[model samples]
Target: MKNLMFFFATALLTITLTFAISPPASADVPPPPVNQVLGLFDATIDFTGADIDREFCQQCHVGSQVERHHALVTPTFGCFECHTLTDGTFAEFRECTFCHQTSPHHTTAEAQARHCSACHGSLVADYDDGHYIPSYATSSFTPLTGGVEPDPTNHPGEYAGGCKACHMEDIGQGIASNATTHHGIGITECSWCHDVEAEATLSIRKCEDCHDVNSLHNIQADSDNDGVITPGTETGGYGHIGANADCYGCHVQSFLAFMSTTAAEPTIPSITSLSATVLTAGQAANLTIAGESFMNTSGGETFTPVVEITKGDNVVILYPLPAFTSKELITPVPATLEPGNYELRVKKDAVVSNKMTLTVAADVQVSAANLTEETIVITGSNFGNQPGETTLGNTLGTVQSWSDQKVVVLMPEAVEGQTVTLVTAAGAVDNTEITAAKATAAVKEKIKGRANKGSIKTKSTK
Candidate 1:
């Protein structure tokens, strides 16, 4: 009984000393129930562990922070995936290099600035002056946030923003729940949004997301390096810069002038042969010229096919038939040509075809007319070396022989004073005062005298 009483007295003394050394509690209030205190602490901590839903994080991360996390994080990942928990609290991670070693963001500011051109080349090329960071004269300028208006001077080229200035701003503060931040609207990085096949295509529409119509036209970059600045169609290094608008829209007449100067000149037509190399003067003939690339009338409103014959400094223009083809064209020879050689050419637009030789012979002329017992001899220049029609008065005559300069024909029964006409392939000649009866009598007298002389000579020989 004495030992038990002493143990109780020591326990009582220890309890009294512990209470005396402890700090005083406020207002002597008793501690809350254990369950109530645990419940309050649980509300501040994420006890769901790895299976926790994203809604648990949304409660704390309200506006742009939530939007930025959703945009950059992969779908399969959650808030805890990139962050760490220490003493029941979550710590924020600012450096992407902590988890991603090869990430594009793992570089210095200068390196990041230089690498911007790889993806944003069109934006870099448009402005002649280099990109610059915006400067505010006073510290009173508040960054854009919930329900705040953007400054008018904050345009792209004015006192405007650079890449980080615009992209890093708090864009989701005033935006609707369904809306997205500026960086979330379109893909800034190729690898993040596009697959291999999509990257290979590199369509121009991707560039139109940030660059407006006028901005693309101002680029003036020879992207393909073909020496021609075909904005919308150019490909390769910079992708497609002009997807929303063409270069001509802003350049106007200057674009047209450039195209005119750089375009290929029209091909000149060639003249190989002509139908009638030699034509008679004072007569019209259908002439056919054969060559390549002869312009037809159906080419369009600007098609004007002109056929011309040039002699020395003189040029005679001829109209080509509408039915002409590229291979050949039929035109009429002008009767104004004198007896000389000329060059025939076809001109289409500013191109003149090769020259072909064309000769014009003098008109046929009658030299003489004579008559024999049964035939009439007609002599002329340019008889064409062929049989021709002959007539005395109203009687038709048959041609006995023909030559280029002379023709003989059997004369039918006709009066003494009659007109004789000779018609060759080239032209016709007429003699108004030639008489066949007088020439026939003269021929009969000459033949009789020759026969008498022949008879006298035979008698002397016997």
Candidate 2:
């Protein structure tokens, strides 16, 4: 009787101390249930062990502790309400759809489909109809997953495709288990093989690790010349499994495609300088791109380099040529480009270069001009490629030709003293004055000779 009384007192004291240390409840905490004698050891009548139910746990776990489990329960419910069925079995034991079907707490369809039928096995089974996924068994001649497998009859101690022939497997080799285990959302994606496969999965690899070049897959060669062969995709066709597939056909075609999937040695491009960074809008300029490793030629055929200019949502792709080299490209900036800050990038096929800034200024600037008779040759920057309205005073002049640097205007009605204006879409550039052109020294000499002749005739006549 004394020992029982002491045990009850100790339990009561422990409960009191727990409540004192814990924070106050945010919500109304239910009163603690009276503990029956011997109920601390065995709570339920079945004596299956301590009841893993909800009400039994709330005795000490009052206050904010109530929110820890009930937050997801949404009604006046607890953990056991959703976790366990009435019959004592788990809700998941019925079906994954039981809880995951309509629950707002489930992952999206894109998240599930990304793993290749992890949650939906029936869909994957439909795609495995020999046409999509071939049999790997020796009884079948064409095996999809037999990339690394030795085929003595076909190639004599030769392995077939590459590392991706297994790691990217959808059907065989515990597909769902590997997908959920390796390709978890926000943790790891499908691009791991092409990116950080070797370094990431050094020991705990999803597929069998590549040992050597001569043994199974001849993949020690860094095809991209990036000095790293772990992420197979960047290494060229030699690394990325998708590149080695039979689609590029099976048998002899497959072998050719697999052999041809070598990533060219990577030539990283960088922009060193641009001939002009800031130009007026609607003013075309000969943009010279000086960079390194812009491989503009291959096998004597010149490659058409694409200059991508982006401003906000606007992207303008221009093809530059006639002056294309490994280090330099001379492209024309269109006069129609809007005035804004633009980001320029050079792309050689799939290889993209470094980013460079280009500013399309709004205001046009006139530097110098020469006026001869009614014709005015306005020389300045940012006059635009297309002829715009050129006015001598208020009278509009007929533009003979227009260029970014110079504009020749013929205005028969134009006076010597008049402000010459060049108007473009961007803005207008005006010369302060169109002064009369000075005569040459030869014209002055001719007039003096004529006067001398007249004086001589007059003296002879007298």
Candidate 3:
């Protein structure tokens, strides 16, 4: 009885000591349970004997003091609630301090202040308050429970209340009930099962031990440290501090997608870059890709870039899916381009990137005919710069012509009437024949039609 009284006195003193030193910040540690400070143990250097206040214990604990031959009358919370022996011959246990004495936690708030700073660096001034305590109790130390009690606004359920309310399994049935175990609410440690094999049986771990997570499956940050990615942040059961861990944290598959995939050595053609990130329509954008393989990936999968082009409000199928020019041109495909802003998406061994954009414009192409005044005028392609160019082709006979984007030329003298042919830098030739112009007026009409085609006009100095 005397020892019991002294222990309660110490329990009360522990509360005082905890409050007397310094209380941690609201953000530092979670609040201990309200009843965690329940009555002092009927102290013993070893706790295996009888509970002193047997009568008082019966009041609200809701269980039995003496368990009979084959059954316990109720659930357990305190020690005696589990029953020592049939005849009251109890097995003693050391006080909680004997074993739990080694404090493996933040000894002081100052030491803990750093770990929280990584994300909360913006709230330096609010870190103003702190308190230290040998144990949590009222004394020379002030309370750092944030307020008089656990702050309701700070989400008590997340910290303490959740422990009790979530243990619904404890109230099993009649007197044969079991103290509620935290079934699956994740209030228990996660590393306990985060990496568990699909066939591993679930281990019932203690609730307070949940935060000790390790391994990638138990991880929470950037796998590649690249800043942004898929299935972000949370890596643990809930999207918690453990979730935002490194890339390997929750997604080993995604990490392996990059780390394990082998990029093929020069198999096709190589590009230097991935091209632009954004573009305008018909802008004639050039893609900047480099490497030897027409296609390659972190993995040895064959792949290519599929390009589609569009211009201000006018999107067109300028390029289609990855189509190889030939087996030698496998994977990476270079587009025979037109004019417009383009979007490129790559699929290298099934790993595709978001669409990248670029610009393209073919403004040099334009039309014209010969004037009766002995001057030959030609159009088609972008010409204006060298207007003094000599007219090499004639409208009178079968005229053959080649054009730079700037201008077209009529070869000197052929026949009185002839059809026309055109050639481009890409080696494309067009001979959509037009009527021969025998008279000046007729030649002028042909010039007007070709001009409408907007082919740039030019004359040769020769």
Q: How do the predictions measure up, each by TM-score? A: 0.27, 0.27, 0.20
lDDT of 1 by residue, 316-419 (tens): 77764433555556666656676555666776665555445566655656655655766667776766574545666445577788888888878644333345
Best candidate (score: TM-score)? 1
Count of clashing residue pairs in every prediction: 0, 5, 95
RMSD in order of candidates:
47.2, 33.4, 35.9
User: On a 0 to 100 scale, what is the lDDT of residue 131 in model 3?
Assistant: 17
lDDT of 2 by residue, 160-271 (tens): 3332232332222212222343433333344432235455432212222212111122112223433233223332222222233322211222544343334333333445
Task: Put down candidate 3 lDDT per residue, 336-455, tens digits, no spaces.
Answer: 334333443332332222223333323333243433323333455532232222312322222233345323344444222333433332112223222233447755554555433433
In candidate 1, position 156 carries an lDDT of 36
Q: Give stretches of model 1 more than 4 Å off.
A: 1-264, 296-303, 365-368, 371-437, 440-442, 445-462
TM-score of predicted structure 1: 0.27
Candidates' C-alpha lDDT: 0.40, 0.41, 0.27
